[model samples]
Target: MKKNSESKAGTSRRDFIKAGTAAAAGFMVVPRHVLGGAGFVAPSDKLVIAGIGVGGKGESDLKSFHDSGKAEIAYLCDVDDRRAAGSVQRFPKAKYYKDFREMLDKEHKHIDAVSVSGPDHNHAIHALPAMQLGKHVYVQKPLTHDVYEARVLTEAAKKYKVVTQMGNQGASGDGVRIMREWFDAGLIGDVHTIYTWTDRPVWPQGIQWPAQKAEVPKELDWDLWLGTAPYKDYVDKLVPFNWRGWWDYGTGALGDMGCHIMEAPFSILGLQYVKDVQASVGTVYVDEFKRGYFPESCPPSSYAVLTFPKTDKTPGDVKIHWMDGGIQPERPEELGPNEVFGDGGNGILFVGTKGKMMAGCYAENPRLLPTSLTEQHKLPVKYERVPGGASGHYAQWVEACIAGHGKKEVSSPFSIAGPLTEALLMANLAIRGSDLRIDNRYPGRNLKLIWDNQNMKVVNFDEVNQFVKREYRQGWELPTV
Candidate 1:
């Protein structure tokens, strides 16, 4: 947290670490800083991190960063003190602020990086300023609430020259690396089809917004919590969770789980910016003889077909079939009926000319068709594995940022994460468009949206394009950079 300038003449913790690591062989004693206890500081290469939305997963994220042994939890920011209570107690020495703007304004210089585990809607707002200030950022998966925001964050990372990572730990997993090596080895020659499914929306979806409003809690700043989204009356059970099902807040199932499940094919095949997408969403009824279209709420279940332009690793166009809400593709003939497919609740499968392969959530437990080939196949490792695999994800970003951008490789940097998130958001566009009632008919359900990636618009469906970049409310504005 020293005032290390971003220039050759300046001595940063990055430089400090590089010097120590280089001379490590000759060192006989453990560094004093490394052995320092809680709230340790100075004379070390420990990265200083300020966390936004430091609650629940946010708390765990900071803990993981500290567990890296090279990071210090320097600050915590969250709108809901109730949710942030645990992290506040754990990192009591770290400064605490209710509004991120205040913390960033007063302490930006003291922090080396920022981690965002806020709602999807506020991701871009929380992450952009830190990057603009030249601090590294680690935001949660499905990087932003909208496709345009994802693209903006992607460009900003490069513009500001900061290390960036999206929290899809699977992207850093050995399973994904194994699958990539297998594909490179031609074990699943020329993948043409893919299926990624999840049994999610464990919270509420396909329901009407509550008519009754609840009084805002004493410890929560409802306005700050609703950053960028339109003003809505405070409702019970919406905060901390259940926000995922609403359009104004969360991106529903696809936004929640797509990045984790779909990342395998994307990484292996180099898929980017989906060209066309179509979807079918399950219906939710209000009562008997009353089939209602609840556009405000995400459909309980849905299936979407996304087509990606062929990459050098593929034979032809690639179509990824995405299913959620327990809907799954028919089992492959090679697998036994009793055997679980994709850990029972979630999975991803790649169908290729020579064979097929599949993996569970986070691309874990990758196996070739017939289950017998999973262990028998002999393939040379083409890529390096992340030390500690998925669990090492937070540490990877911590080290990469401490080493400065481009000094160390991170699996899900925004350059890679942006497009991955954008594709899934585009799928969300199709999902939301499904219930659109125009001319007394639902056209979105039958339409195949042709995406204009350059413009960030759905060229064919003008109505759905509004979602590409949602209108911000609550006196907040999106970042200009």
Candidate 2:
């Protein structure tokens, strides 16, 4: 594990400095007095940011933060130079490094925050160390790879008192707020059932890992790319995006889209931690009568149901059904037979006693079913709309980080994002459990896995616990409190 002052297990910050690494390296820790008093804003202050996994979504995140003007891109890090090309070109002035640990170790004194947009497996590894350094962190969705990491990061955020944000931009969108207003106005009375669906895993899934090993590409550091995942030979097409299908690197379709599509309902209903979960997964048959078994990959498709006990905002237990891999719920009767059902490809539907309402990805274009009701009904807007809506998510985090912890409110801080992520990962536990085979029989099939949220485990099933907190590869371990 990387030693840091923030880690309870490592040498304290004061001790590390006194030991002479700071002196020998000439590392200068910025004094709090220079950053100003708590909650006191210096008009000239700008947050210095470091980007970990600077490619694709990571590239976009960096641009958005730079666009905010309140944040400066001081460093960029990624294992694959090919993926990092665009960002390196775009931010030529920012120092670049291939390993985040090296960058953080050498530049922690200079960075005020870190943006983690790496693959799902390494999110916690990158974000936790930064938080330990007292630097604010902006981690992308599916907050962590396992249930345990989500809980660890959540608790660490509070322990370190750092401003943290999850990159679920929809949390900053107006549609969720509008839906919240509608729900509060009783337009959709007591939503007991909700459905979120997506057409993802467009890449390969329900398939076997490539049997043929290929030479590692020159631009990519295959070992570093693997990060916390167990070592494996490099394979074609897995580097850029196909990693999403493998359980070793990604969280499948649900992890890819759940944070966005589920945010609105989660926010409007004040939902968190699940009580139990059950799932039915779609399988690919290799032959006329035999089903193909690819334990290493995410299934081609899956439909999971999660039960969340009543919260302050909910009238009773809420049942959330998640469908992915082009699987969607039945269209509401009020929707025109020819009319689109939630932007045609993906959507969220809420069934309440009074009516039904639905929205597309990111909770965009939310509408009360029967279309006419959306136009005719207007409720008082009780929630303050986010400035610039979804687009402002980056700027909001930048401003909040600059303002320091607790100085401003953020839409998807880890406190909320952690529970939301854990709930989704819990659903995955059921999906994975459904695939367990015992004596040619599906031992875990169709069973409701009771969950002990406080304990973070399946109360009735031990088989699914393997996924609750995955074991990191020999070299990488999640930090302890």
Candidate 3:
């Protein structure tokens, strides 16, 4: 393998860096801070962005980029035309393609950055190539389908020297910053416990894959949609939305909301990879007569407790409890009977030695327990707040990419996002371990899934290690980087 810095061959990483350095001239002419409006940018300063998976959250991500005014949607790619229609109409001038390879091969020179909003299983494959080509990348939450992929992405960002961000907008929210301030000021003493809950899996989970396969939609490329996952027959209501429940495509509820909820604790407490995990999933019944355990799909509800190694901010190991599928911890007595818990269906709470603090999903509306303390303890903010908070996340990346890697800070760069994602995926290992059945028993349920971060595997329950890295389908593979 050639050294990353040596530019011996054509388009070496070094060459790419030089090209990017030269491109930085477009942004240096006038700084974004001096630019007056949110959607106003000189033509010379625009960052050409290519979007992969242009539908639903993907569509909205592209819209936010364009709204920043610094990003011009130069190219669009998605496996399904039906999903890409809205974005295609919105950015009529952008060249369109059904495959990301074609778009990157033909338009790499034009695209300064890439925004990836494909399914969880497809994130790594979609983002890696763009980064290898030296394009800044913004990937959707959870970062990848598995822990190994997350680690690969984390290292790739450093090796390739690309500006990278995860699509967890809440990471840029003021509430998280304020939480960090309170924690730093010792308002909340050594955080020992945390609780994050969400009501998700609204589609389907804890069940078996549909036995009846449906005809593949005409506008969708079924093969491409499978991307890195193993091939499976198409099923009704699986395209676009309900894929979250299936392990083949999505990371289940944790993938859907873990980034939004667990992020607060991870950032504020300086949490790293999980040390071990224990989990119990809600049971399903078949015809109300027998208990059912479906290994192929995520459970309808799960409660996982992950232990993280001690950090600079913690007195000892941090215990984080994650509840999903409407299951939540007992309400804290400090909260009034009328006061809402976790924005009704979702929330994050920190239990510290001095007091307790809580916030809703996205870490929005954070407050100290006893309610009175929130108003009583106002600490000076040390960390600068992200402009526009969550809404500013898009512009933050756009500006950072223009400023070049190492020049600016992103809210959820892969460095942070990778560990955060691994923590959640580790929890997933426990969840998946609990469901594995032998002849007639589920032995994995009794195991405490110990994590070996160095090797990226579970030391106690070896079977669960399968989830850490998954095999991609033929003709598609993870980027060498």
Candidate 4:
């Protein structure tokens, strides 16, 4: 009774190949009998899932998986019972818990996958254990809270031989795929620079910081929500969406939207890692002690410049400029007056030697410059539909899971996404006043000002390396790579 043969009865040829691959990789390939004479079990075949931090983003992620119809929601876990109540109601059949570890321990055998949509700090804790147990994972973007954790999760996904997908849904969009094709086809010649901007005006930028003595919300589990992050008082301004502007719970403007706006360039250009990053932060509008809860001292605004060294596969060099909190880079005059710019919170502008292309957030509805560029330089008709929608993204991950393909099979697997995330995370570091230079040639070089990723520490700058790996609260240490 070979596992592959037993599972191949009614499975698609592709799925059969996938299952065999998973077995080869040493993942547990359980073959159960199908009740119906249908000959094959559905991919969902007894798949049970757990949801961690089921609140705003977590709720949305749960719905996506539920709609897939490929898995049963078995557990809803959130530190805040109030936040998890709605999700519990939605999936009344599922058990509920506050600590993910407890859920994993009690229901370990019953769970097949986990959706980690917690705050940036807790993303790793929820996803890592599941991957260790060979459970598939679908974590939201800016995948990990820190650069080191991003690399850790990527490695663990491989070590555990489990299916993994990051929740940057735009990576699966048709428009985004077109951007990749256009770049690969040389429409965007020798990509030297890219610009992404966001106008996240939330949380009342430039206002006086709230006092630290404010009473914590009764319905919110502040301690549990703070999981791996350092302890801080409960403040109304830090709850819900305001967390995005704060350093403790979120990654400010860049991390908040980098995965969305930066996905196009990251996917299209095959960006490796940051070479160097510097920033010009704004003046603080509020008192430092009053706003100590957040990362930045300024009025929630900054501009940062990032450089990427050329790889043998990539051309000359590439520079990415990020503008956040209503800042926009000075558009080059070469783009022309008629060219459209992104109006919403996010946009990506690509300037190539041959022509230019611009797209809205998530690379939606991209248009070539000069309008005529579209007609003159059209992508192959066959490649037109390659990138589709978010549903396709989820579907791709599920298919890979059922087939046993590792995370690398997906477009934005952690291997590719990890470095892109590192680059973006560096931007956050730069904005935080770290004087660090990235050396892609060899990571983690100890040069006083240079970062060496290979060594996993900053050259001559222990402070910078310390920044790379944050201090987790007791019992929340991230696994070292």
Better of 3 and 4 by TM-score: 3
Error of 1 at 125 (Å): 0.4
Badly placed stretches (over 4 Å) of model 2 are 1-44
Tens-digit per-residue lDDT, 1-481, candidate 4: 0012223212222222232223212233333332223464544463467888888888877876777776577899888877787898899999988767667655654666788887787888667756665577888888987888887887876666667788888788887877777777877677788899988646654343467657766777677788787886676666666766556567777776888888888777777877677676554424645422233322467788788888653677788889988888776565567555764557888888887788888888886775467667676744434223756676666556666654236767777777877888877766654322345232222221345777655455454566688888865555332
- lDDT of the structure predicted as candidate 2: 0.86
Q: Candidate 3, residues 224-301: lDDT per residue as tens digits?
A: 788778888889999889989999888899989999999999999899989899999998999779898688999999
Note the residue pairs that clash in candidate 1: none
Shift in Å, residue 282, candidate 2: 0.6
Per-model lDDT:
0.86, 0.86, 0.85, 0.68
The digit string of per-residue lDDT tens for model 2 on 215-245 reads: 9988898888997899999999997889989
TM-score of 1: 0.91
Residue ranges of candidate 3 with Cα displaced over 4 Å: 1-43
Across 291-351, the per-residue lDDT of candidate 1 in tens digits comes to 9777789999999999999888776799999999999999999889998898899999999
TM-score of each: 0.91, 0.93, 0.91, 0.82
lDDT, candidate 2, residue 431? 89
Top TM-score model: 2
Count of backbone collisions in candidate 2: 0
How many clashing pairs does model 3 include? 0
